[model samples]
Target: MMRSAALCMALCLAMSMAACQPGPAAPPQSAPTSSVAGPPADSAGGATSPAVTSPEPPAPAAPPALSAEAQAQLDQELVAAAKANNVPLVSELIGRGGNVNAKDAIQDSAFLYAGAEGFNEVLRLTLAAGADVASTNRYGGTALIPASEHGHVETVQILIAAGVPVNHVNNLGWTAMQEAILLNSGGPRQQEVVRLLLAAGADPGIRDPEGRTALQNAERLGFAEIAALLRGHG
Candidate 1:
C-alpha cells in the first residue's frame, strides 16, 4: 500500500514539473525590418523619402496668324501719325514695328505723303526707316513728282541726294523734270529744282505721256530760264 502511494506521488510531481517548464524555447523572437524595393511613405503627407521626379517640358511658342482687326488697327495708327506729320509719333510707331513702306488706302506711302507735304523731317525719318524711294501714289507718281509740282525745292534736293532714280518716269509718262516744268512755272524755286535734278543726272529728254520733252514743256509754260537750263544741257 505504501509502495502504491509513493508511485502515485512521484507521477504527480513529474507532471507538475513538465507543466512549469518553458515550451520548446518559444521559437526565437524576430526584429521588425524594411525592404530596399522602393521609397518609404512620408508621415507629413509630403513627398516620399528618396523622392523621384522628372523635368517639366518647355512652354509653347506664340502663334503666327495675324488677326485682321489687329492689322487694321496698326495700319490706322501708322497712317494717322504719319499724316499728322508728327515726327516723334511716327518714329515711335515705326520703332514699334510699324511698316515704314506701308501704303495708305489711296496707295500713298508715308514717304510719299511726307515728300508731297514738304515734311522734310518726316521724309528723313521714313527714308531712314527703309522707305522705298519709288513708292507710288494712285496716280503712279513718285514722291518726287508732287514735291516738284509744288515747288518743294529743299524736298526735291533731299530726294535727289538720297539716291532717287532722277530719270524715273511714272506710269503717267511724267518725269520729275517734266512736272517741275509743266505742272508749275519753272520760276526761281522750280529753277533751283531743275538745277538739282540735272546735277543728279536727270534726263531732260524724257517725255511726258503727251511725248513732250522737259525743255518743250518749259517753253510751252513760258519758263525762259528753265528752257535756257535745258538748252545748255542739250
Candidate 2:
C-alpha cells in the first residue's frame, strides 16, 4: 500500500512541473506600422524623388508713353529729316514714335513734303511708317497733284499705287491731269505722268473750274503727247 501511494505522488509532481513551463514564446511582438506612403518606384525599380514644378516667367514690360511736347518735337524732327531726304534719320525718328502724318505750321507733313518734293527714299520711309495716304496739303490737294505738277514720274507712280485718289480735285478746281498739262512744259515726264493718271482711272472728261476737260487743257497748252494720251484713254 505505501508503494502505491509514493507512485501517485510522483505522477502529481510531474503534471505540476509541465503546467509551470511557458507556452510557445508568444510570437515575438511585431513592430508598429506607419500610415504614411512611400514614393513610387520607376520602371528600373529605383526610388523616384517627388516631382518639382517650376514657376511661370514674368510678362514683358509695356513701352513708356511720350508726353505731348515730346511727341511734337519728335514729329518736327521727322518732318525736317523727311524734307532733307535724310532716310536714316527719318527711319530712326519713325522708330522712336514720330508721327508720319503730323503736319507742320504750313500743313506740310513728312509724307506731304516727301511726296511733293519727289524725295522717293523719304517718301517710302513715310509710307512704310504709316503715313496717311489720303491726307491733303495746304492747297487742299493730295500728294499726287503736286507730284504730277512737278513732273515727277516715279513719284506719280508711287502715289497712284499707294491708293491716292486719281480724280481728286484741289481747292483750285484742278485735277492732277490738268495741273500736269497746264503747269508743266509738255515734256516727256509730263506726258508719262498723264499716261499713268489715265491708266489709274483718272477721268479725262471731268471739267475744271474753267469748264474745260483735261483733253481741252492739254490741247490749249499744246501738249501733243498728253493730248494724244487723253484722247486715246477716252
Candidate 3:
C-alpha cells in the first residue's frame, strides 16, 4: 500500500509539471485580446465603435524675405515722405543717407511727388531744398503737365511764375495749354492762364504732332469765349 501511494504522488508531480509547460497558445480566440479593446457593447448587444481620427496638418507660414526690388520701392516711399516735407521724416531719411534727388525707377523725382499733390508748403520747401523743377517723368512730362491737367491752377500758376515751360509736351504729344482746354481744366484761371501764355508770347496757333492747334482744342471743347479770345474775335 505504501508503494502504491508513492507511485500516485509521482503521477501527481508529473501532471503538475505538464500544466506549467507552455503549450501552443490557443490561437487568440476571435474575441479581442486585452491589448486591443473593441467598442463598448450597447444595451441591445450592439457595440458603438470608436471613430477613426486623422491628425490635422499645420498651416503654411509667411515668406521670410523681401526681394531687392521690393526693398527699393520701400526706400522710394521714404523719399516721398521727405518730399512731402514731413520734416521729421525728411530729416530721418536724409540723416540715414537717403539721396536728395533720388529718382524712382520710372524717373519720377521727389519734386514731382510734391507738385502732384498740390502741397504748396511742401512744394516750396522741396524747391528751396534744391529739388529739380525740370525733371521729366517716364512720359517726358514736366511737373507742369500734371499740374495743369489736374486743375491745380494755383500750382500751375506757381510753376509758371517760377518759369516752368508752359508749352512742354508729354508722351501723348499734348502741351499744357491743349491739356487744359481738352480736359476743361483751368476754370477762370484757365482763361487767365491763356492770357498769361499769350502775354508771354506763346503762339496760340502752335499745333500738336497730330496737327491740332490749341485754338482748335479750345473750339472743340465749346469754350466759345476762349476760342473767340484765341481768334482775336469780338
Candidate 4:
C-alpha cells in the first residue's frame, strides 16, 4: 500500500510542475523599413534616366587641285600676251607649246594682233608655231586685211606670202586691196601695200560697201599711182 501511494504522489507532482511553467512569448516585430542608394531596379514605378550620347566632329575640308578647264583658261595668257604686244612673252609661250591659234573671249586670235600691230617677229613666230593664217577675228578681218588697212607693207607681204585669202571681204564689205586704197593715208607706203595686194591677185573689181571699186577709191583718194595700177590690172 505504501509503494502504490508513493508512485501516485510522484505523477501528481510532475503534472503540477509542467502547468506552473510559463508558455513561450510571441516573436518580436522588426523596425520600420528604409531604402539605400543603389542601382535602380526595372520593376520600380519611378521614371528611368535618359541615356547620354556624344556627337562626332565634322571632317576637315580639303584644298582643291587645278582642273583641266582651269589650266586651259590660264593658258590663255598667250592671247593676252599677244594683245599686249609682248613679243618676247609671246615667243616664250609659243616655244612652250602655248596654243598659237588660241583665241580670246571675243574670238580674236593671236595672229590678228601680231599682224595688225606690225610685230614682224611675233607674226613670224605665231605663223611658224602653227597659228591659223586664214583665221579671221570677230570682225571678219583677217591678218592680211588689217595689215593692209594699217599700211604695213612688209606685214602685208609677209601675210600674203603665208597664203591668207586676199579677196576675203569682211563684214564691212571691204577687201584688203580696197582697204589699202580707201582706209589708209594715200602715202607712198599705202600705195606700195596696194601694189603688193594687186600683185597677189586681189580682186581689184570687187566693190566696197559704198559701191566703189578699189580703182575708183584710189582715184578719189588722190592715189594716182595706185589708181593707175588698178586700171592697168582692169
Which candidate gets the maximum lDDT versus the true structure? 2
Model 3, TM vs. native:
0.57
lDDT of 4 by residue, 1-234 (tens): 999999999999999999999999989999967776654656676656667888888885543454777646644888888888888898877665677787888887778888987988888888898778889988888988889888898899899999999999898898888888777787888888888888888889899988988888888878888888778877
Q: Estimate, for each residue in 1-234, the C-alpha lDDT of model 1 and write its tens digit.
A: 999999999999999999997777567679867665555557986658674688888876544445777666665677678789898998877766666677777886778889888999889988998989877888888888888888999999888888777777777788888888887766799998898888888999888888888888888878999999999988
Where does model 3 exceed 4 Å of error?
1-75, 82-100, 232-234
Q: Give the TM-score of candidate 2.
A: 0.73
Candidate 1, which segments miss by more than 4 Å at Cα?
Answer: 1-68
lDDT (10s digit) by residue, model 2, range 149-196? 999999999999999998998999998988888887999999999899
Steric collisions counted per model = 0, 0, 1, 0
Models sorted by lDDT, best on top: 2, 4, 1, 3
- Cα displacement (angstroms), candidate 1, residue 171, comes to 2.5
**lDDT (10s digit) by residue, model 3, range 2-21:** 99999999999999999998
Model 3 residue 15 CA deviation in Å: 99
Q: List the residue pairs that clash in candidate 2.
A: none
Model 4 Cα displacement at 38 (Å)?
A: 99
**Residue 190 in candidate 3, Cα distance off native in Å:** 2.8
TM-score for every candidate vs. truth?
Answer: 0.68, 0.73, 0.57, 0.68
Query: Best candidate per TM-score, number?
Result: 2
